[model samples]
Target: MASSRGGSGAVGRANELEKMSIEQLKALKEQADMEVNLLQDSLSNIRTATSRLENATTALNDLSLCPQGLLLQTLSLSVWVPRKSKKL
Candidate 1:
């Protein structure tokens, strides 16, 4: 069995970090907030990419435009397809 540091090792360090003085905690909070904002922005970008991919696939299937349009057309297709549930 692995010996626990009684919350004094890496986990302990993280706990201590959360309990630092107000000033230090505030600084940490600012950094964490910035990181959260960055992650949110990244998540938004990923969602956008996924949306574009889905749109392109739909357009291609609909024969609305050539595949080249998805790669080079200035306009973007941004429609969603509704999936129907099959009755078992």
Candidate 2:
């Protein structure tokens, strides 16, 4: 036997939906359409950001494989290191 008090499963929900007016159904459909549009826009922005990040990562990896001296020159930065003194 099904308990009738609290939990209304799919059948109960379907019965409730069948009682709604056409205008109410139209409003619900419009709301759902807006939600889908918003989600699509968000997904597009995320894909663009992901593409940019991947490009940046690839560029960095390429730079890493270059010799340190060339890398420093390309970036126009200089580093000075002291030489060790010869033993007496």
Which one wins on TM-score? 2
Candidate 1 per-residue C-alpha lDDT over 29-62 given as tens digits, one digit per residue, 9 for 90 to 100: 9999999999999999999999989877876676
Give RMSD to native, each candidate.
11.8, 9.6
Please write out the lDDT profile of model 2 over residues 1-88, one tens digit for every residue: 3665335576787887799999999998899999999999999999999998987788678767865555232332223233344569
Off by over 4 Å in 2: 1-8, 71-88
Model 2 / residue 22 / CA error / Å: 1.1
Give the local distance difference test score of model 2.
0.72
Output candidate 2 Cα RMSD. Answer: 9.6
